[model samples]
Target: MMRDEAPIHAGKSGLRQILRVATTADHRVLDALGTKFDLASRSGYAAFLSAHASLIPALENLLDKGPVPPRWPQRRRAGALAEDLAALGRTLPEPADVPDLASPAQRIGALYVLEGSRLGGAILLRHVTTAQPDAPVAFLDHRSGERCWATFVEWLDGLDCGSDEQRAAIEGARLTFAAFAAQFRAWLATIA
Candidate 1:
């Protein structure tokens, strides 16, 4: 269950749980925003990649400039996303506005969103592969089997978040979710 869904009341004192509560609505809205893509056809899958390409690259770029989370290098999906798009004979869309993940706390918050998505990616990978088995699916396939999420959550939960840090983290997660949502909505507009 996601931090939002089913409520992971375990480790209530941890930053991961805190972020889960703080960004529950944001996560829900973002997921709903993504349901815009059909994902049943190769073209719809391309649109899905386009939507993500617009935001994931911006987040990954910010992480490159900051105190990155554990296994962050391995967690990056932008390259794989680009490779998949190329295989589909498509190019990445322009990135959305970069979220201001300036501080370590803020970056951690962004990382929370980034790592958290991997859980959902498992389900998405299955659908995409079944729907378009021949499509380039590197982005969806990236690290589908791993302990990265647990490692990231443990790192996130262990940190002692001061009030300032907590606030920054919340802001970071909100910005990340919001930016992705906006980018996805814009892509949907184009498709419509």
Candidate 2:
């Protein structure tokens, strides 16, 4: 199906479909952020981690404060990012403003961005390993042998979100993506 088109199946799965559709533009932003960092040198990797340090903590804080289902696994990268930063002789950047995810649906959508990034972590881990073989990449390393995105989707599919909730979720995902992209770009500007 087209990126803009909703999935054929409706209901809870449709929330996932709509989120995917609505965040297509945000995906471009994320892709650009990924490319902006060279990732081939120590400084490049440090810059990348510094960019994440600015965003991850705030996002995790929002998720921590928001209403999430008790059974859902909390995926906080702030600690991992800090560990990687310290290992690389880098420090965490000041936290950025997190996207407002007030409702459960919105929190779920924001969580989707965090969980979904793991799908790309495997590839990033490879790059980090090649660039800095011994550098601590614990955040990316955690995805090893884990079906994180699949598990998240299964949990997402089980949630009972109506149309309004689905829209809120989509908005939350878009906002989270946008916030991360904006923070990364701003951080780059400061370093450059």
For each predicted model, how many residue pairs clash, with residues at least 3 apart or on different chains?
0, 0
**Where in model 1 is the C-alpha error above 4 Å?**
1-12
Q: Candidate 1 overall Cα lDDT vs. reference?
A: 0.83
Q: Tell me the tens digit of each residue's lDDT in model 1 across 75-142.
A: 89999989999998989887778788889888888989888988887888888778877878788778
RMSD of 1: 4.6
Q: What digit string (tens of lDDT, one per residue) describes model 2 on residues 49-103? A: 8877888887777787655544444456788889998988878888877887888
Candidate 2 displacement at residue 176 in angstroms: 0.3
| Residue runs of model 2 more than 4 Å from their true location after superposition | 1-13, 66-74
Pull out the clashing pairs in model 1. Answer: none
Clashing pairs in 2: none
Instruction: Determine which window of 10 residues in candidate 1 has minimal summed lDDT.
Output: 2-11
lDDT of candidates 1 onward, in order? 0.83, 0.76
The TM-score measured for candidate 2 stands at 0.87
Best by TM-score: 1
